[model samples]
Target: MRETSATRRGVLAAAGGALLAGCSGLDEFGESSDEEIRSSRLPDLTDDGESQPVVVETMPIEIERTVLAERVQRTTDLLATLPMSFGADDVPNGYVRKQLIEAAEDASEYIQDARTAQSRLTAMRSLQRARSEARFAAAGWGFVEDGTTETARQSEHEAVIEDANALRSDHAYLGEDPVEAVLFHAEVEQHLAFVAENRYPSGSVNTDELLTVAEWGEHTEYARARVDDGRYLYDRFRESLPADAGSIEETLTTAGESLVDELQRRRSDLPAEPTEGDHELVWRLRYRVRDAAESSARYAGDEPGAASTVLRGAEGLADFLAYERIRDRIDDGEQFGVEEAADVHDARDQAVESVRTALDESPRAGLARPVLADAAQQIVAADEELARLRGTVRPARLDDPIRRYVTATARARSVPAACQEVLDTLTQ
Candidate 1:
């Protein structure tokens, strides 16, 4: 798990990224222009004969932010899986978790396939540099090396998917809890699509701006590819999860839906217009920055892996439940009797504490805040609800507490209603 800015966690996810456009030979987004700048007061160059071609570039900044989000999402997906993998069997849980993590690492190798606009531009610049006599000139080492590397690395993707998937399916009955990898997969895909759509313009945008967007595009493309490969592993892991292990699947499903909704809101919440460009040269920059910020909707969860953290935390609680269930099975006659009500309360309290710890640790692992927030909120709510349910079970015989168990389940057995509430405000 990656460390997060806990200091900033209190802040509602930032309203959005900063967007500005200008031409100081740099776009308001802080990207360099594509035009080979020349100092001149040429009458034809300006409406007032006072301005030069100040092409604005924005793709660089956008790409930088987008890539960061993706990297964070990728890491969090794995870290958040821990608590969920727990069940009666710690060894299998650890084994499966390791497999998932390893699979993610394998996916990462190809995530480089997608480059941001900047990387593409860098490639172009390197080519130019190689041809130039400038002391800074040096050809990007790749061209052919990159292709070979891709070829060598590419085959691993499909193989990883196959292996991971098989493992998950094979282990499905282990009584291990789930981490809900599908939601993670879906969100990463959404981010990939978002990044792809923001492809920076080449001829119309600044050189640096073009490079930035291209770099981001490449990166997302890589992520998309890796994720696509990861599907096999993640899916298998989910499938292999013990059917009776825990209720993490349900909890993660709910959290994922909420996070996805928020993602959608952010996607739609893009500024009605790209930042206003001061000049035609900077228009592309404005577009790229908006696109970058928009794409961020995928990776920048108010929480890491946004909804994933909640599921991960719930997995921990669910695993504990599974452990209790196993103990119950072994006890034979040691049922949920009123005499053991105190013990049940203790178990419930333990579950709550475990969940809280999971929430705190989840964010530390880089799960997004919004996701963690939703999860935390849900867990807290669920725990409270369970307590209320336990009260109902009081005086009742152990055999009769089933109804209480069903009723005391989290109010949000599905996606959180607040998910929609939050999404209604977030956007492109």
Candidate 2:
């Protein structure tokens, strides 16, 4: 027989009573016993040992509704930010322009459908449809083969596509179907691969080319931003899934591995020599250091461990930047000028101080505190190494010192990698 809400409630209440009795030793004074607990907790079974249906909580549906509403609202806001028209000259291809316009229109319709969806299944379908439209939009933008690329426009298009895919994935996981979750994940990966193929037809940027330092710096910033968004979305989606959603964990782990592989590729492709006029790297480092300091301060009270990780990553990145600055000067055959050395020293000192302050102010509890303290010490050591290298002239062979510094800051670089694992665990 199918259990009604009242029957389910009675069963749960009795199980709770048994638990309380066991925990508080109140069973000694009552009729509660092991057999009673088992009877209450187990489902009624027929002669063939088949259990009856049990009414589950509405929490899963509620989570779906909440997430759908938020996603729809976010999509609406994104739509508003996109330009209504790309002038004839903007794309330089009439067919591409038409495709983009159609994709935008389709996205708007799908989002509307999602907003009005009456069931979880309908909402999931609508969100995925909208995500497809976003992907189409990305492809359309990617087809502009002859125009000057506008970074802001390209970034916005990419953001919309990524956000759409993320929303759809969240909805699928929340639906509690393992197959759907896996399929949705695969769909996202496919779209990402398509975007990559289209955006960089010749593969990744060539390291040996005469690219500006600012260009590479922008790429770093973009990658960091994507990581930040991924972390936040993964946390939210994991929370929405059922406790027993083991498939979600597996999917996320696979995704993390893919991300790690991509990051490794990019890191491996980094140029050994500095690009001409790449002074932007220094400013980027300064900005990242300041951002990390602010984040540490913001998270210090409630999430001291997270704050510590941020500080550690920032410290390592700062050291990396310092090395780059020195390398840039050496590549240019300039003597490590006194003024340039002072600037590098100041940047490193500021970063070190920020991390120290974060560690000092963060609560000294939990396993994270010790790990963070160790990382802080490593940062100090890195700073000392930089000091030793500061006044020295350019060596004939620079790879050795750079490799040494990379090894030294390896822990800091691993912060994001560790975070990816932690994010996957949240599903468990």
Point to the candidate with the largest TM-score: 2
Q: Against the true structure, what is each candidate's TM-score?
A: 0.23, 0.25
Candidate 1's clash total is 44
Q: Name the 10 consecutive residues with the lowest summed lDDT in model 1.
A: 132-141
* lDDT of candidates 1 onward, in order: 0.31, 0.36
> Tens digits of per-residue lDDT for model 1 on 1-428?
11122221222211111111111221122112232211111011112111211111111111234434444454344333334332435323444334333333333322332222123322222222111111000111121113223332334334534543443343221223222232333333443333334333122332332222322333333433443433433444445555564433454445555555554564564446545544332343234334433544444343333334343333322222333343343246433323333333433333333333433333122222223333233323333333234222333323222222221222112112322333232211
Q: What would the C-alpha RMSD of candidate 1 be, to one decimal place?
A: 27.2
What's the distance in Å from true for residue 241, model 2?
A: 9.5
- Candidate 2 structure quality by residue, lDDT tens digits, 1-428: 11122222223110000001000111221223422222221111221111111111111222346656655654455445445676787666565466456656766777765565444534444555454454445434433432223454456546645654554345333325432333233333333334333432222443421121212222322332333333334455566666776545444444434433433343444444333354443333333333433443333223112222222332333333334444454456643222223333333333334333433333321211222333334333433344344223332222222222232233233333333333343234
Point out where model 2 deviates above 4 Å.
1-61, 64-66, 85-92, 116-118, 121-125, 128-428
